[model samples]
Target: MTPYQRWTLRTDATSYTVRLSADGPWAELDAWGPHGVETGPSALDWSHRTHFFTPADAAPAEYLPYGLRPFTGADLVASRPGEERGVWWEFAGAEEDEGALRLAFTDEVLGLRTVLCYRTVPGTDVILRWTEFTSSRELRLERLDSAAVTVPVTGPARLTYLTGQWSQEFQHTRLDLSRGTFSMGSTQGAPGHAYAPWLAVQDGENGPAYGVALEWPGNWHLTAQAEPGGFVRVRAGRVPHEGAVYLTPGETLTTPRLACAFSAEGLDGLSRVWHRYERHLSGERLRRPRKVLYNSWEATAFDVDAAGQLELAKTAADIGAELFVVDDGWFTGRADDTGGLGDWYPDPAAFPDGFGRFVDDVRALGLDFGLWIEPEAVSPGSELYAEHPDWVYRIEDRPARLVRNQLLLDLGRTDVQDFVIGTLDRLLTEYDISYLKWDMNRPPTERSRPGAGPADRLDLDAQHVAGYLHVLDHLRSAHPHVTVEGCAGGGARVDHATLARTDVLWPSDNTAPLDRLAIQYGFLHAHAPHVMSSWVTDAPGVFDPRSRSLAFRFVNAMCGVLGIGADLRHWDADQRAEAARWIARYKDVRDVVHLGEARLLGSPRDVTCGVQYDGADGRTVVAALSTGPLDGAPLVPGRPARLRLRGLDAAATYRDADSGAAYSGAHLLHYGLPFAWSAAHDAELVVLTRE
Candidate 1:
């Protein structure tokens, strides 16, 4: 803990002033921007960075393109004709209610009281909650620095270059109204479209914005607006898209709203976040991924035929996978998607003696055991539904629309909460489950209850908010060592909110690494690599059929979760051997891939992009991407080959990461690497460890 910094939030003409205590742990966090903030002053920053914007800042013509359009001092004054509206300003509203500082602000749109409290938890955390609310839509954020409460916005979403002789970084960040959503953070994208909001940080290896863009704080509750059924529209970066969202008038959007605690740990996360982002943007391949894990969803879906999934798990373990996860379909009578939700009990028919036996088998194979669950949802046919028909969320008497034949259980209700927590508790107690895959398949809008009043008391818009946090808190406490992941209908709800709660975030269901190349690029720009979900991907619709280059498939999933979703059962000896080698590579550098800084060398949408990773051993994983014409074969020449990097140590040894080729020079060079490729192919994973 450093010393001396009292931050006072105030209003300014264009942006806000976040003055840090002169004699503090950090120098100062002063930034003059139109969006959230950025970490670097280089194009490489785009590798691991994202931008933010709100509806308030969108229409302001002066702040066109809301999120990241590069700003000049002259443009600071409100250049648009309209008085920027919406929840435009936020700051420390009240003194600590207990040990916590209580902050208050209005959502502007719904005129709802959005109060938040932050204070150290005696010896542990700095707790924050959005309570004492008139509207059920209270906001809660986590991972805030218990000590500091202010910082400045700079980098990406703001000015491309510093101006007005200003060079203050956010020592502590407080919100202010600007051209877009916040007073100063005009980091907005298309208003009425579905998008996920992202926050980016930088690390080394990945250039500039190539640090940590960690999304999914924990469990998030998100909504777009105050009106019912309005989709939330939050975008990250220069139009690269990640997650599904939209905006409308009726719904109120409530995000995870996590308070980033800037400790030494945060710096590492920040670095990894940017690195992952850069990798995706550059369309680089990974020599290794964070978790040497495998997912069973692709191999078996909800139809978890014991032998089928078991074989997949066996292959994953044999390929040096550290964790084996049976995604979906393990619960009692839940053999398929049509049934078995809400029934937390393990299915004896599926696992015979429950997961305990499977766990023993996987452990014997030197792999950890993991389970999949969607505790927040209940199947209409499940026993829990039969017993507690009133617990599912609904608008009282309105008819329910079932997704995957299930209904959402309201965490706001204690009984529902108890049921979920207890079920999870029983599972942990009964089995040696080390991981949990928390999935929410439906986007809740129309709130309902079996027998509640007509008045809207259920935080309908905040369902995701309250629902997710409740689960996170329980899992964190009851199963302290277990790793939890947030997966919402693939990658729809991936944002900073859920990042705080879980260890990782499953980016999306689209496993085609090429598509994932774009998806991961967009996701990394705003979230952390530790949690990005992907697999030894396959094309979208094709099943049991024509195989694309397995190497290309390997390259695609290498950067993310780095597991195989393709039916390995169908793979013969040669293909299996190749898959094993890829997994072996991932096992070698998985730590660096998951934790090191990432740099996006080029645009994923372009004909070329490359991802590079740096390690202590001078290890680097460079994934080069070429969209059409060239397959990800190696070294295609004639295409522009000069590579610009971000977040590098700048003075490290170098070599041909793949071919053992040598480079004779200083690690830092203004001209970057030579312009050449092995051959113009689709993708290639180039690994170079400095000897």
Candidate 2:
């Protein structure tokens, strides 16, 4: 009798156990949840067998290839030119070191070695999982997923994911899964606004939540299937180019890390697990306080001039902006989106006094200078494109498709990567630029490399991702002083890989107060607030037309890294004064807001919704908002809307910073902090300090 082998990986608050069945070579999930789950009966016990299905197919597999998981979805699908499209592998060995573990399997006939790797993030309940494949023979990998997670669910699986379009990005969507499969992915070169590379699952409405997030920045997919044997499995990884990727002999292909998290406290608690892991990814960089920025896009647009920008810089400085960013139109030939994209040089006409002089002048106003650039795109009429027409993605005979009035450069090529690095290095070296807002306005429409071989074409996506990361890595190492803000139209390129490289992320282009509130509500669920770069703009409400005051806008943006895109030059004296006050207030509580334990109080759907941050010093800051009108009626007559705060010390007494009012923590937790809603005041910033 072959004894079943078991291994358990433990994090700060969670545990994941994997077992190799005596009946087969495959690994099955024994338990995944709170720390003590492994001590209980196995979640994947053999009792729940399915008819007409192989034991390997019905079992909660940790990771399996096509031959083993024949009936179910496979994590890896590979084949040689004339060989069978399945793997019949046997367990080679397993290695454990510190908090990392690796299980190896090999197919002797194919000379392929597959390693499943797992590493527990220190100080976080997150287990990072990925697979590495090395083969002696060349093969085509149709599907290579990073990790497949088998979540134990008692009832129907409830799924929650993020999905939206350009300006409407980060909308939280939910679905229940009793059976069948649900899939979401991005074929675009980026992690598209259509769907984020993240998913959260639960057993039922009240069960513990499990989450999986892929770290890939390029095209990726996440699929969840509720099997007939009463179990849910999720597979996530980078989406291969076209439908397959080529693996050369002796070359190893490592999939992106998939972060798997569990929280017995629910989805909101699961969010904190993600947040802590992100902060861990930030390392020492998280200590640097994100600046309050002022962008001149809405004010100047393409009509940029030195004097006008200098004037705006002075106003921005007066309003307490630490950074002044010249967004778009600062570069040569960039009068509109149609041209000047590939031209990285500053426009001589717009900056008649010289670009360096303009940057110096902005710095003279006591504000750090920042510039926006889309390095991966090109305009047909631009000099760079004309000089090297073969640089963009296109087949030899097919016409290059245009998106956002521009073409995407084939970043997979080394020459293109060098150009991007050189262009950015020149800009940062020449000027005293402290920030770079890296924007990708469009996805690759015709993603193909001319004259490339079939194998090369299949490797395009992976190479492009590597090249993109290379440029970002160069910026980090070559110029560490510069703060990189990641943007893709609006949150299109957001993922752990991008977030690990960038200092901040622009959530959306739509800054309309109510619309932004909903976006932030969803954004905070999967991402930490410290990385969310939200802006306050004067744009009219697109999703919700109900007008909100400037205070509301400031409070909404203050939920993350606050930036002002509204034209300060057009503001009246009172508005400027109010803006200055809000800016000052944000600065006072910024540390707590950025580093504190964040909790979503009431949801955006509620009449009174807010974000609460509890600081280490026992100071709590709440950005409360009134989502709907209070003119007609109230839910309960003679009662104001209240937000019951969480994570409060029940016996502590707290005092408001501004109102000078005091209340008990027990009272606030049970009855909540009350809000008197009115048309004039639809939002309020409450700062409470424990006494």
Write model 2 residue lDDT over 271-368, tens digit each, in one string. 88888888887778899999999999999998888989889999989989999999999888988889999899998888888899989989989999
Candidate 2 TM-score, true structure as reference: 0.98
Report lDDT (Cα) of residue 570, candidate 1. Answer: 77
Check candidate 2 and list the clashing pairs.
Answer: none
- For this target, which candidate reaches the highest TM-score against the unseen true structure? 2
Worst 10 contiguous positions by lDDT, candidate 1: 159-168
List lDDT for all candidates, in order: 0.49, 0.89
Q: Write one digit per residue (lDDT tens) for candidate 1, span 1-691.
A: 2222233222111121122212211112232222233223411111212235322222111111111222211111111113331232223244544354444444444334434433332322112222223233332211111111122223222211100101111111212112232211111111101334333222222223211112332222221111111111122111111111222233343332232222123333343433433344222223322456778877777777566767787887766678888888777777677787888876778777556777777777777788888877888888888998778766655788787677877666767777788888988888787888887776444455545543333334344356557777778777877877777666655544455567677766666545556666655544545567667745552222323367766776776567666777777888788888888877676666665666656655555566676765667777665554443322454544545555555566567755777643353245455434333335567776565
